[model samples]
Target: MTKFTLYLAMAISLIAGKVSAQDTTFELKVKLIANKIDAITKEEKEALKVEIEEVNKQLEAGTITKAQADEKKLQLAETRSKNIETRVGQAQEELKDLVKQKVDGKLKEDYRRKFSITFWDGGPKDDEGYKKYRDSINNNRSERRTTSQFVFAAGVNNLVTNKAVAGSDYRYWGSHFYEWGFTSNTRLMKNNNLLHLKCGMSVMYNNLRPTDNRYFVTNGSQTNLETAPMNLRDSRFRNVYVTAPVHLEFDFTKTQTNAEGKRLFRSHESVRFGIGGYAGFRVKSKQILKYSEDGHNVTVKEKGGFNTEDFIYGVSTYIGYGETSLYLKYDLNPLFKDNAVKQNNISLGIRFDLN
Candidate 1:
């Protein structure tokens, strides 16, 4: 019994020593992999910082807003994470190769087989898992997709002032104006789809027709309203703008089941509204003078600044149910640049959006 016990002790000691040596080697390999991952992460972090700093500079310069910068940061972080993961995967492959080379035949085969089972189980490639992943991706894409609407608006446009100017009366029908634009609305909150931000470009035409046979003439930097020297049928001052508008819109449209039992939520279908403003530079200006010149019926188009404001800004609001709404807008800035009168623009019209 003593001899048998002595042989068992020797065998156990040999096994323990072998296990200790293999544990040390495994720990060293783990440390090496950890160091490599750290290096990759550090390099990527530095690059990300430089890119993010450039975006911050743009935000400071007012070239981009805070929201835009935040989006860029998210994109950068996602890309950086992907890059680091790829590098770590390569490091893992290198580690596996090194282990195979350094370890003895049986130990190498055992470890290599274990690593293959542990690290390369080829995660979740079954039909069920693949279907779930694909569905998740599709849902995410649908949520992020942006929708567009074509908007058309027309109404009577006139100048609003604290006090009336001497000769600045406008004929109602003749001073009619129109606006058309294409807008895209994006939901800012994932959970709350009621709030959205809308932005787009529009073309606005403001036609001002005087009460009497009068026209606009610019002298130096100031515009003067004057009567026609001769009998004039029609005279109008036209201003055009290429503007970008931004709005915070609320969509209270509710989801409903159709005849086919499919659930549908049409945008701007229920009680919906938006309050926003626009800022844009002037595109062009023209004066259409229709009068008898040299005994012949002549139409003259005068193209110039006409002392019109170059930058236009206005507050706008819309309220209604369904796709059509009553639109109201008032310009905060003056219509004319250097005029004796401080006349601002106000308009009320119907706005339609095909969403």
Candidate 2:
């Protein structure tokens, strides 16, 4: 009974020692990884600052020409890229080591009793464990991805119509106008080659003019005849609307290497095509009409009072390159519902992504 007790004490002491050693190693590994990551981050920042300062000095001293400065910029970019790659590799290795240690410790605790052993020999091999750990680290990095963007656009619209005449002659008249809207694109999708979706809301102001024409009228008896020409003037319309648009953009372009030998995906140059629809609600509307004969401005007729419906629906098609997207939209509803004005509103404009 004494010998048996002595053997059990020895086994317990060995197991306790092994556990203490593993715990210390695990803590030390964690500290080392943290310290290394901090060191790498500080080094990367300092290197970037130094590079920028050197470029500025070169530009100020004229020792390096503009072209040479550009070349040096490329070099600095490559250096930064390489530094990032190195840091990622180091992080991956450190994580692999930490994971291996943990797995080995757990395996030993769980499997040691069954096999009459103090440590697990069946823990993941070094290479396989490293790969698994690196994958986990990459997953964490992917979760941190973010992007920013910006956009701007302007457009023109014209109206064509004829004068209202009873018996005389009909003439063609039209007016040209313009509108502008600015918005920034906030990116909502991220995979390098996948279709990206973005949405933005913008405030647009438009100025519209309606063309006018005049007709002659002859009224008389058999002995007397009189002719008079009536002067017609155009009406200018101004309105502000809030527009919201959603885009599903696809980038179909080849990745190219820049002068610095870094792979850059050129945007805006990508043959980007998107189909989107916009909904705009009128905020304010006013009409300014000019009488040609009287040479005075007059208030023209308006449809849909302020308390009524003030919304416009438009479906747009976008086909263009890069940051500039060419768009064509047709208003779904007529501008005036009560009037028999056989006219449709159409617009051609450029869309920009600002983020």
Candidate 3:
């Protein structure tokens, strides 16, 4: 049985064992009626907890979403709550019978044991053995070396110039980037959280805005940011990529011992740092130019090859506590194909290890 039920039964047993035959009948009726309510409440609560735990397992297994689990739990709580009130009313009727039996000296003092044992729902499936079995299974979950979480990051986007990660020729605040993906982190050492290998597939959207009224231009196999012929209100360039990233992460979270004395190592519970890189092909590129023409606003979107590198590779790193981290990445490959002065892409951002 659950701790709540056991403690209650113990208290009632103590009181009942000490009560004398000289005790008033009215006092005995009140004690027995209240104990009946407590016993009923405990049984309903235990059953409801079992149902909700199953829903949570389904959510973690990806069989149902979090919303569904919440809904199921709410429904079970409401049902059990109503059932408690209804059953308490029925137990009150038993009090009336007990009153009549007591007047005739037929209400046996041994009836306390009946209430105590009945609180278990009366079997191996519903007693202390069942609770112990469930607890053992929980503490001895199947061994798993890998776990997964959703990842998303966003921040300013610019290029490294002369080894500095700054937007030298581009608008610093206007350029930005966003990354969203799923990652799996695998433990490298048995019963340890110090090191892990993190790998993932991500889609990246990197944007750049040139300063001094400039926009990207393509000439044959060359691409450069050139001064626009028209005074532009906005000039922006965007690149998209599907990249696979791998990182060697060091997690400093302490390993904890469960009730069964087994060690449990979980990720993202403390300070963590990761150093790794990504490699992938540029999926697409585009340029946007917005200006006023003859007192009317005009927006132009140009989609082309732009002579940007088809394949790209980059170095990235992050360091922080738990779910939030400072993220930085710099592309090692040249931005354009065979340029005399190669320009590389760089980005600084905030990442969320959203599970």
Candidate rank order under lDDT: 3, 1, 2
Model 2 residue 318 CA deviation in Å: 2.1
* Tens-digit lDDT track of model 2 for 1-355: 2222322332343345542322424433444454565577578878988997899898999888889888888888778856855784577466544444454454344432343221225454355765565445434433432333433334555332233222212211232222233333322444364355556665555545433342111122111112224444545455566788666767565555544554444344456787777787876665554454566555445532322127877776776654445666666665443334433456555544422
lDDT by residue for model 1 (252-278), tens: 866455445544434565677999999
Provide the TM-score for each candidate, comma-separated.
0.56, 0.41, 0.60
Instruction: Choose the strongest candidate by TM-score.
Output: 3
Best by lDDT: 3
| Candidate 2 RMSD to the correct structure | 30.3
Put down candidate 3 lDDT per residue, 41-63, tens digits, no spaces. 78999999899889988999999
Q: List the global CA lDDT of all models.
A: 0.69, 0.49, 0.73
**Which stretches in model 3 have alpha-carbon errors above 4 Å?**
1-143, 165-167
